[model samples]
Target: MTPREYCKIFAAEARAIPDFGAVPEIIPLYLIYRPANTVPYATIEEDLVGPFERYCVKERDGSLAVQSSSEIAQKCCAFQHWLYQWTNGNILVTDMEGVGWRITNVRIATKLKGYQGLKESCFPALLDQFAAAHRCNRYCEILGLKSLESLQQPAKPKGSKSPSLGRKAPSAQSSPQLQKKGLASPQGTRKGAVSPKASRKSTEAGEAQLAPKHKEEGSC
Candidate 1:
């Protein structure tokens, strides 16, 4: 059965204290409404306390009858089944459920070593954890449980400097050094924009000056 159908069946048919007594036909275990943009823990204490207190195993002998640890253990079993069915073993329960399970596992270990009545100490917290897990699931559904790594801005590489945003920083290599033009620096000449004619004339003049002087016969 689908989880929702299972939940509906549980709400209607499941006995809270394992005995026939007046109980909520529908336990609103799942939160449906809350303040805008806010996620809060589920209100499950009332749901647990009512049925647990009302339908606890009654002693036939005339004495003070209290809730049994066995009943709590039964409730825990139901909780585990629901959790497993709901999650379908795909996503691991973390946060409250995870923490409570850790404690319960330790307690079980201690119980195996001769400890008893651990469920009396463990059940209430487990109920709270179950409620928290429900709340978390609801929150994830509403807000979406996606990896933020794709949405997040990528981190800069290590040791890389950030580009300044306030003002443009001057670059050392941007402005090239001016190339010299002829013997004189022309007032209008740009660094790399030297006139080709002036360059050719300058080369010819330099060659003439460097040539050997020839002595010739006296002219008439």
Candidate 2:
């Protein structure tokens, strides 16, 4: 969904919750699942279990709470129940492994944050849980937010070049080269410079040249 639509969903859901006051500053969390990779059992225990224990301790004092989707599911009984309701039991307890449960929780948490005064209720521990589960640190960079020291910027997708950095997206009339490449005469150029019919004929001639060579090889 578009960012604005995402924001709206968060607002509506947050308002529906009892005792969820004004919204907090909402940040969108994008979760990408990578289940094919082997999970390092030691790393998972250290990273997930360790901090989770600490988070529960902090929650008792009202100083920290879980905010992200997965953490929220783990921490809040109400939210866990809500998940079952929302998914119509498609996500059973056994199905939580490698599932993006935390991503959904983070979305709900952020929406609640947008309500009048719920940011404090949503704790940093929760945000951390969301970040860990869904790798939010990388997404934060895409949205131009702070990057975690452990997180590297996501690679530019293969064969997909970004438009020049700092350049605005080009409009139809913006690039003369693009106009020429599209076989449209550049605006105000000489008539002979670009002829649509001639361009078509030239393309046909080039294809013909390649075709005869292919035919000759087949015959040989």
Candidate 3:
């Protein structure tokens, strides 16, 4: 069944229960095919248990337990039930001398019409679970499935900071004191050309300095 159809069915079934509170959001179910490596028990446990422990309560016997994993337990249990119904417990469930859980029976059901729907909906949800359990993106690549990274939008470049509007713009000609301090220069005097009066005064000053030096040399 397609994920949408399965959700409808689950919702109807849940609503039929008397005294049940409002039906929660339907969790997406995924069929995982682990042909070579089984997903670890720790990974599954952590995904279902670690995040939902806040819902757990202490019993009268002082034992702590939860009714279920937050909302995802519904999805997980449903998927497990579906797997059991389809595979009849003949499927491989392996553990290499207490190393970890590994199921080698996972494969894409290409013949079924609902397969693509499940892949599009359930696979990503399953990938999220795997990712939450610290599985790398290559986990999908190994299964010949699209990784979440492939579907993500490319990161946009950061914008350059704009000038603040509060500060006043500098004027073309600054204060005379600033010019004297060499922090600012008058725009008109930037050219190398010298004024006629200033040039004449400089020439006269050079002549006056040279006359004293020339007189001393002649006297020597």
Candidate 4:
């Protein structure tokens, strides 16, 4: 089934449980790929692969229980089938009992020869299918799951200056100097001669004074 369908089934099944009020916890499925020629680390392989195999076995027997009260066994089985198909049966389950849940741990070791075609086709298709199936927009809200927007650095403001910490003060010699040169001093000028009105008034006053003198001379 498609990833959305899987999620819907998962959600519905989770809702059917007695106390399934919150979203079901999703555990990370780890798969490691390595070259076949190298000697396998037995302890690491055993630690990782054992639990996953046990979980598959228990899940196959209907003994696995999830928090969801609904029929999630079919969904889990389908998921396992898809995983096996993707891995081309090279995937091995290593652990299951430690967490007391049916979460499978997986490991993959590549065979050097006769698997070139399988690796080229199956690996890419598997990744594409897995990406298509489980991808959800809801992961945008998860903490530490960054988005494209988050990857961008914030913009800096224009003309920003560094703080004046532990720097020397400006020197007084740097102050602007007024240039004094051979400039001529302004000479004060005398006021202009009397206005036309004043001149006319003075002439009229002199004529009035001569008229009185003429009238007195005629009387004499």
Candidate 5:
């Protein structure tokens, strides 16, 4: 519901401006579920055919872990950056996944913690380090966002380690001098549009080896 609402908000924002720059249009999958239903998923998402690529565009702590070489992917990352600034450092969407341009299974990290299913992702610490962890990608500038680092960051937790590049005010296209904020900058770029899918290990053969059971009295 959050993703759907956000998508609507962004779409409306884009429509309001006479000349909004090109941006990635994210379409979130809606969930239709009922308790005690036999179906695993009520609204099963269409599984991807061929090689399905999954990439982590942003980190929980607001850093660009994968500054993807693909322009589209970069735009996706910038959306996350824009959201933080749009909300005045309130909510940030991360843990992006899915194939091609449609991102699903995302995680939302915000300052106000402990909401239903978002407890792990919404911890305030993630947003606390935003001004430190975030690196301004080009699309962020295209959206008319100034260096996000210029936005005053909340004080980090005591004894937390600072980023390797340290803290610095953001520039549209330049890296600012580092200040003391606990987090790391980009480790490196994950180039290429599609990532190679890793194989998932099958369940233990031992489970299949369990003794066959007789039917319980009057069952079914």
Candidate 6:
């Protein structure tokens, strides 16, 4: 599907996704078009401005090489994985780009109805290689996207996260000795909570890593 249709469906499906409060919102907007001489219309999108910056979440071949990738970019990668499993591996949108999480110019590699979407980028080999190409990120686990094991075994959504085998999740308790040292003060955040300073530091590192363009991997 074109970005026009794709963005619409993406917004609808994304609503069910857990936002984690702090992650940048994925607000894919409409694709505006203008009349063209040869074609009926020319595809165009709004230009991003100011301190706002564009980011590459994943390459066309599904490489996540940006080691310090922003949380938003990492989240976007998980979105691609979720989309793949949501469609039963029929589609894996890649080459994602946008300012913040307001994405555009994404390429969809689809194997639905025997139709290979995006003739320029979607190829048979790429489809088979995706199982090896993608490496699940922390966000992927948070969203419960099943790891891609093989081409024949298409991943299906594991749905909302729930304990495996009915086992309880680890408690967030801390030892009294640790609390005395202020490592786990009652007034302080629970485990996994990030401080404002640390969050900003991570964001800066991720933006620096994203400054360079991602190299093309494989044929896709």
- State which candidate has the highest TM-score: 5
Error of 6 at 28 (Å): 6.0
Q: What's each prediction's TM-score?
A: 0.19, 0.19, 0.20, 0.20, 0.52, 0.49
* Model 4 Cα lDDT, one tens digit per residue, 1-220: 2232333455565556545344322244434655574853323222333423232232433232233323233334334333333445333121123232333233222323345344332232333332333321332222123333322345576895678856777655554441222333233222354578899999999999899888888998
lDDT of each: 0.34, 0.38, 0.36, 0.37, 0.60, 0.59
Q: Which pairs in model 5 have colliding backbones?
A: 161-182, 162-181, 162-182, 162-183, 163-183, 167-179
Better of 4 and 6 by lDDT: 6
Q: Which stretches of candidate 3 lie over 4 Å from their true place?
A: 24-68, 71-220
Clashes of each: 0, 17, 3, 10, 6, 0
lDDT of 6 by residue, 1-220 (tens): 5544544564455556666433434444454555665565545556765445445435555553343377877766666666676667667665566566566666666664454444444543445556666788887776666778853564597868556858865544645555568555655555567788999999999988876644333334
Candidate 1, superposed: residue stretches over 4 Å from native: 1-6, 11-26, 29-68, 90-220
The TM-score of candidate 3 is: 0.20
Which runs of model 4 end up more than 4 angstroms from their true locations?
Answer: 1-41, 44-136, 148-160, 164-168, 173-220
Q: What are the RMSDs of all candidates, in order? A: 18.9, 27.0, 19.5, 20.2, 38.8, 39.0
Off by over 4 Å in 5: 11-22, 33-43, 55-64, 114-121, 153-220
Model 6 lDDT, full chain set:
0.59
The TM-score of predicted model 1 comes to 0.19
lDDT of 5: 0.60
After the best TM-score superposition of candidate 1, give how far the Cα of residue 194 lies from its true spot, in angstroms. 99
- Judge candidate 5 at residue 206 and give its lDDT: 44
Local error of candidate 4 at residue 62 (angstroms): 32
